[model samples]
Target: MKHLLNLLAAIALLVWGTQLVRTGVLRVFGANLRSLLARSMGNRFSAALSGIGVTALVQSSTATALMTSSFVGQGLISLPAALAVMRGADVGTALMAVLFSTDLSWLSPLFIFVGVVMYMARQDTTTGRVGRVFIGLGLILLALRLVVETSEPLLASPVVRTLLGSVSSDLVAELLVGAALAVISYSSLAIVLLIAAMAASHVVPTEVALGLVLGANLGSGLLAILTTLKASVEVRQVTWGNMVFKVLGVALVAPLIGLWLRHAHPRLGDIATSVVLFHLAYNVVISLGFIGMTQWVASLMARLMPPADPASKNPLRPRHLDPSALATPSLAISCAAREALHQADLVEAMLVGMYTVIRTGDLKLSAELRQIDDSVDELYSAIKYYLTKISRSELDEREGRRWTDIIGFTINMEQIGDIIERVLIDIEDKKIKRGFRFSEAGMQEITELHGRLVDNLRLAMSVFLNGDVRDARRLLEEKVRFRDLERSYAAAHLARLSDRTVPSIETSSLHIDLLSELKRINSLLCSMAYPILEPTGTLAPSRLQDAAPARPQS
Candidate 1:
């Protein structure tokens, strides 16, 4: 019982170490890894290579799947390219197993000591995150040593020997046991290392270890599929396609395991080396064999899981808030930004339709337009919740600021949507229902203001998307011009009222309120510029300074 407890504790420690490495690496290099994946998608081979490199760093193919699936979900990369990337992720995992199989017991203590010092000195900075990674590496090595040490006593037991001999004779049972271990450990690399350790101790034969390695590969694929169960159909398609590749690889290789054990085992002097080599060669062959078939697999997945209708009224389903992306702050920020643009798109539609609804006094159109506000509200909530999941401690200074900007931008959009809905309601109740109309000149002024509002909105979205200082300055300038236009329009309406113009007198409240609402919308649209210019010191403390009286008197 004590021996079993120690073995279980060692396995748990191994899993915890892998978790630390994955999260620590993501915190340090998440954005760079995302950019690397994005830029390397020029072709299938490069995409695969990018996958291998990223998964190796993060120490999990499942992380690679989530990242790649997000790129696909956001329409940044094609499905076939994502599929190819996942193929390389498999090879990457196998490669890590090969590297970790070497004896590194000497460095474990050194890594833990240094890691402890760095983490204690700077717990919140990037250096500290690197320290955390070191600690995880040290723990992983320690756990592997523990697993080997604990298994030796168990190997001496007659009952354990009987169980081991039974597993060696039945390849199918060994495969299932190996797969279960991978799933339970949540790391194929861990399982492979454990298997290699066991094989080295003669607790398990090399042939049985090979079958278990094959099972570990399948288990990793299964884990990826399970991880993405709640994701979009497109994302699920990517994971499912990868699983299909694994299944095919297993089917093709399972038959040859017996032949390899007979012929290949004698050549490799070390059983552990033979097991690791078999694992590597299996993945390399699978990667090469399936690289070209990614497109076909993607097409088949598409046929299996067709795209959701764009016009569906699913309010709860977020089009851009991919939960998997929350691990990488930069990727999560990108998802939020895309969703913000989606919000902007909806706001633009509302603004564009506002003119027609107000001008024509179409109360029915006004009611229909109100429905869009619900979508805007839902998106805002979803984005806020998604942003909250991103660990602020993991973000660098620049990324932290970006996180703030995204939240601010989304809040401004939600407010604008509310303002538009209110404007539509006022037009319906105060103007249209009361049988009031603005004078020809007043209507012309509102029309011109509305057109400029639409243009400024598009410009604001561009400024938000690109963070271009020049365009941000232009947006700020337009804000001032818009305010000036509002004042001039208000003054002109009063002038007509003084002249006793019938239309102006009848629609006095509606005209003034309409102009005020348009100005409010413009202010919200131009607010996106501040975050861009404030950091650069190009923005002034107040626009009123330009109109202040000259200091000549002083």
Candidate 2:
């Protein structure tokens, strides 16, 4: 029981260490990796190479798969290219297993000690996070050593020997067990290394370990498919396509495992070396064999899961809030920002239709714009929920601020939508239903204010996307100008009311309300710039400067 506990603890450490490395590398290099994947997807070869490099850095091909699948979902890369990336990711993970299979226990203590000191001292900085990666690697090395050490003693027990010997009785059953371990562990490389450790200890025979290796490879494909279950059809298609590649490779290799084992065992000397070499060679053959067939596999996937009918697609659904990306902070932040932009687009559509609705008193257009606001509300809710799922502690200062900015922008958009809907209701009730219009001067003032409001909305979106200091500063200035114009328009409307212009008198309340609401919308849009400028010291501490204190009793 104690030995089993030791073995389980070591395996848990392995999983934890893999997780720490995956997340730390992602948090540190996510933005760069996103850009790299984007650029590399222009071709199959480069895309696969990029996947290899990414998986090697993160120590988890699952993360690479998510990143690539996201790109395919966005229509940024073709399905074939994404599959190629997956192929490369598999090879990369195999390479990771090979690198770790070698004896490197000597470096474990050094890494853990330096990594601990750096992490404690730097704490929240990038260096601290890099140190975290080091710590994880050390733990992984240490854990692997412990797994072997502890499991070797258990092999001598009669009960343990009986249980272990059963796994070697049927090659097919042994293979399935390997696949299950991979899925359960969430890392084929970890499973492969563990199998290697067992093979070296004579806990499992060399040929039986090869069958398990085939099963482990198959299990990883299943893992990818399961992970992307909630993703979009396009993203899911990428996973399914990759799984097909894995299944085909496994089928071809499962029968040949015995042939290779019989021929290579004499030369390889030990079961551990034979297992790792076979794992590496199998992945290499699969990658080389199928790298050119991605397009054909992509076509098969398309046939299996045809695209949804466009007419049935919901306009209100959030496009960019990918659930898989939530595990990676930088990617999740980008998802929220893009969805916020989507919300802004709907709001812009409402704003553009507002002027025509008011001028022509067109109830049909008014109703349509109001309905569009419903979509806006849905997007806002989706984005807010998505951003909240991100762990703020994992984010650096800049990313934390971006997280806040996206939430703020989405909230403002939701409010602007509500206000626009109200404006439409007021227009439909007060003017269109009552057969009233603004006088020419009153209409002109409203036109100018509406035009400025639309311009500011666009500017606010630009500021949000680019975070340019100058653009942010300009947005703030435009807010003041918009406020002044609303006041000016109100004064002009009153002047016309005093003159008793018939149209102005009939629509006085609606006209004034429109000005007030437009100014409010403008205020919300301008709020985008404050976060950008605050760190630059470009914004005033308060809108009103502190008044000079008068000398005592002056």
Candidate 3:
């Protein structure tokens, strides 16, 4: 009972290590990794290579699937290309299994020691995150060693021997056990390593280990499907296609396992080596065989899970907020950031439509535009709720600050939507209903200001997404320029009023209100810059130069 408990504890440690490594690497290089995957999709082969490289670094094919599926969901990559990337991801997992199966016990203590020193010294910096990765690596190695050491004692027990004998000849049962272990562990790599350790200890036969290897592969596919169960149709389709490949590979390879084990087992010299080699060979063959068939698989998956109706009313539902990701704070933050950008896109659409409404004086268009704000409101609510679900305790200082920034950016976006809605109402009630029009000069001023406002909004989004200090600085500069333009436009409108220009005099109140509201919207849009700039110490304490002292009142 004690040995069994130790084994289970070791297995749990392996899973924890895998998760720590994954999340740590993501926190440090998530955006760069994403960009690498996105840019490498120029061709099918390159896309597959990128997938393999990324999955190897992150140590999980499931992470690769999520990233690829997101690109497909955004229409950035085609379904077939995404399917190819997943194929490479499987091979990457197989490679990791083979690599970890080697003897690296000597490095475990070294990694943990160095990792602890670096992490404790600079817990919030990139170096600290990299140290976290090393710590996870050390734990993984140590866990494998513990699994081996603990399983050795089981060999002496008659009950363990009997249990092993029962499954030695039953390939299907062994395969099922392996798949179950993979799902339970949330990592096929860990399961494969565990199987290797067990085979080396003679607790499991070489043939049985191979069967479990196949099961582990199938289990990983199932894991991806289950992980993305609540994702969008496009994402589900990607995982489903990958799952079909695994099922087919397993079915075809199950019958030939006996023959290959008999012929190849002796030459490999040891059971662990034979098992790892078999696992690698299986993935390589499957990758090569199915590399060209991604298009067909993609089409079949699309048929199985058809795209959602384009006119569906619930378009505001959160697409990127995978509940599974909430366990990894960095990943959860990324999802929130992406959804916030989606909110910004909706706001941009409304802003563009407002200009058209102003020019055409179309009350019907204004009414339609007002309905669009409902979608914006729904998205804002969804993002806020999703962000609140992230556990604050799990977040480090940098991640905590990022969380705050995302909240502030989204709040500003929601406020901009409300301001635009108000402006539309004002146009409908004050300007359109009274059939009042600004003079030609006044109309030109509004158009120019609106164009600049739209441009500034886009820049603000770029700053939010990239956090480029230069762009943030430039955004602040534009804010000043915008304020000056607003003042100048107001002065010009007043001068026109002083000249008693009939059209300007008639629409004076509406013109002034419109300019002021636009200026307010620009202020909200540029607010995205402050969070980015303050972190880098590039933002000033005040936006004003020193002013003269106030004189006493008379």
Candidate 4:
């Protein structure tokens, strides 16, 4: 029982290590990795290469599939290209299995020691996340070594002997058990490693281990399918196409196991090496053979799952706040950031609508703008609530900062929405209902300021999205220019008032209030730049310049 418990703990350690690597790599390179997949999809071959590269880094093909399919959901990549990427993801997993099966136990303690020092020293930076990846790799190696050592004692028990004996002759039963383990664990890489460890201990024959490897591959495909069931048809097509390749590969390989054992058994040496090699060979054959068939399979998957009805989509529904992503902090951060962008999109529409109301004095436009503000509020609530579910324990230092950034942006957006609603209301009551018209100069000032506000809103969104320091500084400069512009424009209005211009006299209150509100909007939009700037020391802590002591007048 102690040995069994140790074996189980070792298995648990393997899973935990795999998860650490997945989440850490994502926290460090998630956006860049997605960008690589997106840009590489120009051809199936390139896309496949990207899949292999990304999966190798992430250590989980499941993460690769989810990320790739999301692009498909957005129409960023075609289904065939996505299917190709998934094939490469499978090949990538096979390659990692081969690499891990060898003897690298000597590096385990070294990695853990260096990893702990790096992570502790720089917990909030990119270095810390890289250290995290190292730690996970070390744990995985140590756990695999433990599994082999502990599993050996279990072989002496008759109960364990009898359990192995029942499946020793039955390949199909082994296959089913392998698939089930892969699905339950949500990681074929971990399962494949576990199977390799067991085979090294002589708990299973070489042929039986190979069958389990094939089943793990199949379970990986099923995992993608079950994961994206609620996803769009474009995404579902990619998973279905990938599944077809896996199923076909398993069917063809299952029959040849006996022949393979007879001929290849001697060259393979030990049972563990043979199991991993067979696993690699199986994926290599399928990846090479099926790479050309992606287009045809893509067509079949398309027919199997047609595009969803246009009417089924709710325009106000959250596009990027995926519930399942909450398990992974980096993924959840991406989802929340994207949803915040969606919120900004609604806010942008409101900005445009408010301009139309002010320009044409159209009272009807105010109602439509109000409704848009409501949508912005709705999105703000959804994104905030979604982010709240992510556990604090899951976040490292850098991710913690990013989480706050997203929350801050969403809150700013919600306030911007309220301000827009108020601006619309002021327009309706003070200007439109009262039937007042601005002087030509006054109207021109409003138009010019409104145009600049819209442009700065776009700029602020870019700065928020990219975190570019140059752009952040530029945004701050514009805030100063805008404040000056408002002051000058207000003085011009007063000059016209002194001239007793009829239009200025009739619309003085609304024109002055309109300029003030636009300045408020610009300030809110520019606040996003402050977070980007403060770290660089480029922005002063207090804008109030130090008042120099009065020079000695004495």
Candidate 5:
């Protein structure tokens, strides 16, 4: 009972320690890492190196993989680049196992103490995250210490020693045990430490420990592999490449196991060090071997997972609506908000494109605008369905607020799309039918208003992405200014409408309708930014306020 209790305590410590480390690392550098990964697209070597470096620093490949997938989904990193980075991450994680081989008990508490002070007292986000990393490190070390202590008694148990001995004697058995240990813990470092502890207690032979070490290597690649399953084929290839490299390394190194045994005892500390060394060696070798071969790998992956036909590529597909995502309501909400924002951006772009075609009187460009409008409608449907699904779940305070923001923004974007499709598209198409053209000054006024609106929308997106309330407020101010400019433009259009000699009916009528639609699009686009800027009240008709309170003189 006492032994069982000790084992349970050790298990509990291991779990807590890992949690502390994982959480701490994410808290400190997750956003920074995410930003970095986002900009690492198109370069496989760079992404792979980044992956390795981050995993080394954070001490967890799972964290690296999770963040990597999110980046991939955001179109931050190309699939191939993500794969290459994952390869490096696999090797980087070995560094953590190496640290555990040394006596780290003394430093653990210090890291925790410093980490806590920084996390609690520091105003700088980067500094606070760094503190979290240290605190998590402390917890991981403390857990290992407890786990090691609990397993020490097993060394004296003849049955335990004999059982471990049998598994160690055969290379295949050792490999299987090592892999099994990793799977059971769902952590390569954990299994490696366990094997190290067993070896230190002389319950497992050197050869067996080495074989288990190889198995742990294979197991460590599992999380990356699983993460890549839903990712692009290029990503899938990178993960497969990493797995193949590790599996082959184990196979290639198997014969050399005897040499390793002769040079080193299978002591817990030694085995732990070996695991780290092997991890580093594997990554260094694979990265060197595959660095320049990214294109070749990309080709193979393409052949295996062919790109979807352009005709079949639905730009309006809602990405964050994966049922698996719903399991984490907060993450789901965040994802939904991101998708909604993406749809809004598409509509904004289409509106600009349509205006461009209208200004240039480019018939080819007008056709393209119609296609963009079609896509906008598809995206609107996708967002509506996605939000409906998201609304089905129970929501906490922050989540509820986020849901409201996404739904509000999505509806606003949908309205903008409707304006473009139903109003703008109609006017542009009618102009083509009537063979009408706006005067240069008329086109210029409409273009300027759109330009200002796009600028404000850009600011709003930046504010949302950064969560800068101050910036969001600044955007609100800009929206008010743009509203004033819009009123001035509208008045001028109406004045022209009153002048029968100013233009022909077809051009004048289209111009009048066009200006109204532009204002509506601008207002809706501004509304997206308003929710974050002034959540309590509607964004009233501030544009009308700056007008001379009358139409412009004819």
Candidate 6:
């Protein structure tokens, strides 16, 4: 029972430590990481280097891969460019093996201290949050080192050795153990560290450790496939490309165990060092050899998966609200926020389209705008449902407040959708029935006003995604501008109404309704930015409160 308890303790520590690293180090930097990849994606070589560097620092290729996949989905990066980055990310992830082998475990305590100082004392600064990430990573590494040491004695027991060591000599046996370790970790890098430590202690032979390395590579594809589960067919194809490369690499390399042992580059230092070298070499070889075949692989994936149905690409419903994401509430919140922002952007775009259709009196354009509004409505519904599920979880106070804000924002946008359907579209019906026409000047004013509101909406969405209170405040200021514009424009129309020689009745009536709808749409756009820029539902009270609102606005 005592032994069982110790084993359980080690398992718990392992899981807890991993969660800290993921949420703290990986997630905190996710947006910056995304930006870095986005900015560096002009060429395959640059994209590859950026992918490797970012993944190495973040210590999670899955995160890097997901970000790259999203960029590809957005048409920010070409398919070939994304594939290169994915290839480089595999190599970059091997750095984790080297990190585990280092004597950096001693710095874990210092990391925690610095993290606390940055997180608590300098909460408003990116530098401080970055410090917190280092702290989390340091503590996690320390915990992993301790767990391995505490569990070392298990290797000496006959029952344990027999269970663990029975297959050390068999190639298939070693491969299975390696794959299992990867699944347990969800990181090939972590598994490599484990294998290295075990090999150093002579708990497992060098070849067995090497086989595990191969298996770990294959295991990482699990995450890629899972991420693509809800994505478009192109994303699925990219995922398959990831899988095929890793699987084929493993199949070819694992069978050459004897060759690697005899001819692979020799290493200095201990077995851990040798393991690191082996892991690095493996990834580098795969990347260099596979570079030329990128187009071929992409074509094959396209052939196999094909393109997604146009209808299926309509709106987003988050699968991230799953139990898996809920286990890490912080990560789930980030993903949910991303989805919400996506929905908000769709709403803003639909509004702009509606304004164009109404102003120009274009029937074809009106039909297109209506379709977009419907799509936005679908996305809004999906995001709201996902948030409702998230609200049931045990969130930290700050996260709870954010949930309230996002839910409110979604509801507000849904109302905007209703307004478009009921009110704005009705204007079109009237225009068709009454042969109403807007003056050329009236049309220009409405279009320009719509542009301003759309700009505010886009700015607000950016603030929400980045959590930039200043930008949010700037959006609010623009809302005041919008109000002034609304008042001035309405006054101008009334002056025209008072003239004895005014335009036709149909033109005057059309101008009146268009201005009213424009004002309403602009108001909603301003309201959407309100929560993000001022979480309390009011304008930001001070610059010091840069952190997103801590409570829901009434």
Candidate 4 local Cα displacement, residue 327, angstroms: 8.5
- TM-scores for all predictions: 0.87, 0.95, 0.80, 0.83, 0.65, 0.69
Supply the TM-score for candidate 1. Answer: 0.87
Displacement of residue 374 (Cα, Å) in model 1 is 1.4
| Regions of model 6 farther than 4 Å from truth | 1-8, 11-19, 26-29, 116-120, 123-128, 262-269, 309-374, 385-409, 420-554
Off by over 4 Å in 5: 34-51, 65-84, 120-127, 155-166, 169-177, 180-186, 266-299, 319-341, 345-408, 415-523, 531-554
Alpha-carbon lDDT, every model: 0.87, 0.87, 0.86, 0.86, 0.65, 0.68
Rank candidates, TM-score, best first.
Answer: 2, 1, 4, 3, 6, 5
Q: Could you tell me the lDDT of residue 484 within candidate 6?
A: 85
Best of the candidates, TM-score: 2
Name the better of 1 and 2 by TM-score: 2
lDDT of 2: 0.87
Q: Model 3 TM-score?
A: 0.80
In the range 1-554, model 1's lDDT, one tens digit per residue, is 67768878887888888878888899888888999999999899999999999999999988898899988987889999999899888888888888877888898999899988988899878889899999989988998898888877787788878888888767689778888888788788888888898788777777788899999988888877777788788888998999899889888998898887788878987888789889988888889988999989999999999988877837434578887676567788888988899998988888988899877887777887799999899999989988998888777777888899989998999999999999898888888888888899999999999999999999999998999999999999999999999999999999999999999999899899989989998999899999999989987687465677768775
How would you encode candidate 2's per-residue C-alpha lDDT over 1-554 as one tens digit per residue?
Answer: 99989989988888888888887888788899889888887778898899888989888777788888888887888899999999899888889988988899998998899889989999788889988988998998999899889888887789987876787758779878988998898888788888898788877778788889888988888887887798899999998998888888888887887788779877888677788888888888888888999999999999998877779988667888887777678888988899899899999999999999988888889989989998998888888888888888778888998998988998999999999999999988998888888889988898898898999999999999999999999999998888888888889889988888999899999988989999999999999999998988877777675797878985
Is candidate 3 or 4 superior in TM-score?
4
Write model 5 residue lDDT over 1-554, tens digit each, in one string.
57758866766666556655665554455456666666765467678778777887666665566566555445556666766777677767766677676788899889889989987986345577577667767777776677667777767778876787677568887777777666566677767766666556555665677678778767767655764566544445555655666665677678876765566435524555664565456556666666666566656666876755758756656555433233234445667777777776777777777777676667677666566766666766766666666533235345566677777776777677777766555655677666677766687887787787787667666665665667766766766677787678767766766775344345766776777777777666666566565664545657565646677798
Error of 4 at 205 (Å): 4.9
Tell me the tens digit of each residue's lDDT in model 4 across 1-554. Answer: 89989999999999988988888888788778988998998888899999999999999888888888877776788989998999899889888988888999998998898888989999767898889889999999999999999999888899987887788768788878888989898899999999998988987777778888988988888888888787667877877788899888988888988988888867878777788888878887788889999999988987888886779877767788765455456667878999999999889889988888887987777898898888888899899998998876567676787899999999988998999999889888888898887889998898899899889989989988899999998898999999999999999999999999998998888888888988998999999998898888887668576996878876
Q: Hey, what RMSD does candidate 4 come out at? A: 4.5
Error of 6 at 76 (Å): 1.2
Better of 4 and 5 by lDDT: 4
Tens-digit lDDT track for model 3 on 87-135?
Answer: 8998888888788888998999998999889889998788888899999
Question: For candidate 4, what is the lDDT?
Answer: 0.86
Among all windows of ten consecutive residues in candidate 3, which has the lowest summed lDDT? 322-331
TM-score-best of 5 and 6: 6
